[model samples]
Target: MTKIVVDPITRIEGHLRIEAEVAGGRVTDAWSSSTMFRGIETILKGRDPRDAWYVTQRFCGVCTTVHSIASIRAVENALKIAIPSNAELIRNIIIGIQNVQDHVIHFYHLHALDWVDITSGLTADPAKTAALAASISDWPLNSPTYFKEVQDKVKAFVAKGRLGPFANAYWGHPAYKLPPEANLMATAHYLEALEWQKDVIKIHAILGSKNPHPQTFLVGGMAIPIDPDSQNALNADKLAEIKRLLTKAGEFVEKVYIPDLLAVASFYKEWAGIGGGVGNFLSFGEFPQQGGGQPWLPAGVVLNRDLGKALPVDHRKVTEYVDHSWYEYSGGAGKGLHPWEGESEGKYSGPKPPFQHLDTSGKYSWVKAPRYEDQPMEVGPLARLLVAYAAGHKPVQDAVNGVLGKLSVGPEALFSTLGRTAARGIDCLLIAREMPKWNDQLMDNIGKGDYAIHNGEKWDPDRWPAEASGYGMHEAPRGALGHWIRIRDQKILNYQAVVPSTWNASPRDAKGVRGPYEAALIGTPLADPGKPLEILRIIHSFDPCLACAVHLLDARGNETLKVAVR
Candidate 1:
């Protein structure tokens, strides 16, 4: 057996290292580690509960708005405060836009290259590529001349040897299965997606006052002042602009993104059985009804691939185990503790850098093993799709069925890496379709002269009880995300966030049950252990964001570890 390590996995948000034991051309065992320690939960101690959202939003630049939403929801849950109708509608629109924008970025910018071979695009016939693009969807940019121009641009960049974002990739790797024409088409959409994302963020700027990390969230509701007459606030013109942007984004998802995903999946049908880890799935329901009723994305757990029985997720049953993690639990090293009583103490006792393999018997990752009902549950788009489909959500069911029909694959195929990628595209369409409904609802509420955006009754700290605890959760673009908070005297007593990456990228637990990332790697066939593009494909499908999972920095901001991969 030989050990293969890909440390500081590229094209991702932060540091993540995957070490796998390969024997007979297949991965036998794997360890997923977040190589740095981020003490966001530790920093939140004794801070004002209302300020938690702002601080936690810094957890990750890409997921800024998600952490903020969860933090405010946690505080509101503790106070038993219900937001006004307009606030709910506004928050939904903001989050929906975030979902659409983030998914597009993930596909075109981050994960597309894993399947597309850029160098092969040079050999593609532009006319054939245009035909392929037109067959997928009636996206108007499919002219042969347009594709020829895109090919020339790529050729020029290669000639200059300045690939920029396209540099250092495992180009022409055997794992990339798309034809040259398909690759060229995907490459064109990738450039188009870059322009599309810019317009999408304008919607965020109009509503949330900023794009990356919006400051619109308040503990009880949103902070956007509503005024039809004033041009400064969320006025009529601003609403119209948002609607127009939503319509544009919806067209991109339905026409370009979803079709491209299906076209790619058709070539890699064998992937439908690979990387299906920890059949149990979890989703903390999100996007509540107009008045805080049933969530649009149903919250539940599907265990052992039994789709017929979707069980409700009880946050109380969630616990984190630090057996193979860097943190130490007060109760013991391998003991599982609820988040409200969670601890984030750093203690790195693993083999140092330049090491051959991880001491799987010892601590390996910065991410603690989070288990729901003592089982490692998979989270993210696949989990949300499964939970919603099992619950008979009409829109979700229809969207999923439409894709499955196009791919000509049964629902069982939804368990693999390709399915996970497809689920994100399908969910993006669902959220984009709902955006207009939410905008219309907000407008109707304003027309009725009900324009309240916040409830200041709980803003004062003195109004809080001596002690309270609550869980704030959202079906973030990456999957089930929850923030557990315990407050006392209006200050945060304890805080813990079990983010999506924490659930998917975690290591083994006390019972020696492998986490999703680890389990998915086993039995995977690697064509070349040295290049290991297959490993990246499966892992990137989870959209690992270790910045949200772990962090570390010295006082002088110097580098921490010096490592070598063999």
Candidate 2:
């Protein structure tokens, strides 16, 4: 057996690394060591719980709104505060818009090249590509002339030795299965998506006061006020503008993104049998209904890949283990602690710097293993749709069944790597359609002269219990994101954020159970050991964000371990 290491597996900004043991051109065992510490939870200690939403947003630049939402919700959950219907609508619109945007970005820019051969796209006939694009969707840009223009631009970039984002890829790898024409079509949309995403995120700027990290999140409710006549708040003009932008975003998802996903997936159907890891799924359901009941998406768990029985989620069953991680729990190394009792003390015992292998025999990674009912489960778009579908959510059922019919595959196919990718597209389509409805709801609330954006009933800390603990959850673009907090004396006592990547990218636990990333790679067939693009397809499908995984940690000013992949 030979060990292959892929350090910083991300396309641009990377923090996760996978070292696989390959035998007979297939992965046998894997160890995923990823580290990027923000120490945000530690910083929140003694700080005002209400202010955590702002500080936690800095956990990662791309995950700005996710952390902020989770933090505020945790504080509110502890205080038993209910936000107004207006605030709920506004938050839903922002989150839905971001989810739609993030999914599109993942497919076109981040995960596409793994399936599309950029060099092959240059060889495609523009006329044939245009025909292919037109057959898939009636997107107006599907013209021979337009495809020709896109081809010429890419040709110029390659001629100048500046491939930009297209650099660093295994251009002609055998694993890329798209035909030149299909590749050309996807490449064209790749450029178009770049322009489309920028415009759609303006929804955030209008209501959020800024993009990346929105400033409107408050513990009790949203900080942005609503008034039909005011220029400084959510007004009639702003509401109209939001609906218009969301409508256009929906069009892009249906016409360009969904069609492209199906096209790419048709060529890789065998993947439905591969990378089916753990066979357990979790979702902290999102897109809540008014009056705060079960979220529209439905929160549930599916164990052993059994879709027939969708289990209800009990937050008390969630626990984290640091057996293979860098931190040490006060109870014992092998002890599993719920987030409220979680600790993040950093202890480095592996080779310091200039080390090759991670010595997997001991604690090797900074990411802790999160388990539900003592079982490691996968989380993200695929998990969300699976749970929702199993729970009899009609819209999700229709969407998943529609995609399964299009692909001519059974529900069992949804367990693979490509299935995970397709689930993202389906999730995007459903939420994209819901964005306009949310905007309309906010508009209706405004028309009724009931523009309450906040519920400050528990804003002051004076009406506090001596001790309280609560957890917040959000079905982020990546997966189930949660923030657990304990408030005492109006200040944060112990805070922990068990982010999506931490759950998906977790290392092995005390019982030697591998996390989703590690398990998914166990049987992946690597076409080439030196250039293991297949392994990447599986890892990127999880959308590993190490910055979010290695969060809530305090290294205590220890010397940063010099990271080396061998």
Candidate 3:
């Protein structure tokens, strides 16, 4: 048996290292480590409560909105204030837009490379790819010359400056086996989808004033209002355009994205059965409504350890355990208590602990294992889709059932690694189909001139004196995200973030329980130990944002360490 390691898996976000012991053509044991940390929680101390939302969003450029919403909800929980109905609806629309747009970009550009070979494009007959696409999906005609023109455009973009991310890629890796024509078509759509998703974000900037990090929403209500009679009101024309953009996104999903998924699935059918991780799943629910109404998404857990039955998630039951990390501060090996009571002091001063002294039972990573009822669970698109389906969402049910029928697996597969990737694409298509209808509902509310607003009007100032605890939770693009905070005298006293990756990419717990990622990597088959793209295909399928979990060791014959983005 040989231990294979792929550290700093390139071309995606953050630092990730996968070490798997392979023998007899199967991964026997695996450790997935996210080796960095940015003290965003430490930075939040003593800042204005309102500014927490703005600042926390910068924690990740990829899903900044998710962080922003979680921060705002934390503050709202602390203040005990509810946002207005219109504000809630608008926030949902923006969140849905980000979710859909991110999924498109992920499927076409980032994750697709795992399945489609870019080097294959060199041998592809552009005419043949066009013909294939036309025959499969009845796609709008693209002649041979049109494909050539598109190729030249991509080449020009690559030449002008940075190829952005696709630069210096190992495109010619011999193991990449897709046919050239399929690769060409996939690459073409990848470039096209980039522009299409960017346009979707334009709608966000029009309403929220930014793209990567939007700024319209606050705790109690939106900072920007869409009054019918205000000077810069959201006019009918702008509303119509929003509707049009959403409709176009839905059309793209129905016509292009779904076909692309089906087409790509045909070539990579083996993936359907590979990388089946721990089937435990979780979602915190999302998209608020009026009058203490329910959110569009619901919170729940599907535990494969419990035979795939949907389990209710109690916020109070969640806790983090830091037994396997490098930290040995307070709470050495116990349940992950609330962030408001978290300890951040580092106890170690060594580059790497003596292997014999390594705390296998406690302190392995900076990320905490958030156990819902003391169990390792998965959270992401697949979790959300399953929760929504179990909660009786017809669209989610239909789409997921259809995909499962195609894959010919029982519903249990929805909890696996491949299911996470497949569910994300299908959910994106579903969200795209639903957003225009949501926009129309918002427009009708506006047409009725319901411009009422709230700005923390009802909270008692004296009761806000200081020293309070609260929890913030939201469904991010990847999955369930939450922040638990404590405030004293208008300053943050304590803070902890339970991000999506913490749940999905966590290490073991106090009792030596395997994390979702570790268990998922167990059975993955690696064709080449040096270039384990198969392992990456499973890892990146979760879209990990581990800028927070990485750290570096340096030496001048003395131990010095640093933590930063890779």
- Give per-residue CA lDDT, model 3, range 478-497, as digits (tens): 88998888888877887778
Compose the digit string of candidate 2's lDDT tens values, residues 1-566. Answer: 99989887866233877888999999999998875554677878999888899998888889899998999889889989999998889889989999999999999988888899989999999999999999999999999999999999999999999878888888889888888999999999999999999999999999899999999888878899787778998899999899889989999999999999999999999999999989999999998888778898999999999989789988889999999988778788777899998887667666765767888878888889999999998999999999999999999999999999999999999999988999999999999998788888888878888889899887778887878899999999999998999988888999999988889889999999999999999889988889999998998888878887765333557555678899
What are the lDDT figures for the candidates, one per model?
A: 0.90, 0.89, 0.74
Please give each candidate's TM-score: 0.97, 0.97, 0.90
Using lDDT, give the best candidate's number.
Answer: 1
Q: Once all C-alphas are superposed, what RMSD does model 3 give against the true structure?
A: 4.2
List residue ranges in candidate 3 displaced over 4 A. Answer: 151-164, 167-177, 229-231, 305-309, 347-363, 459-466, 548-566
**Stretch of 10 with least lDDT, candidate 3:** 548-557
What are the RMSDs of all candidates, in order? 3.8, 3.5, 4.2
Off by over 4 Å in 1: 555-566
* Cα error, candidate 2, residue 96 (Å): 0.5
Candidate 1, run of 10 with poorest lDDT:
551-560
Tell me the TM-score of model 2.
0.97
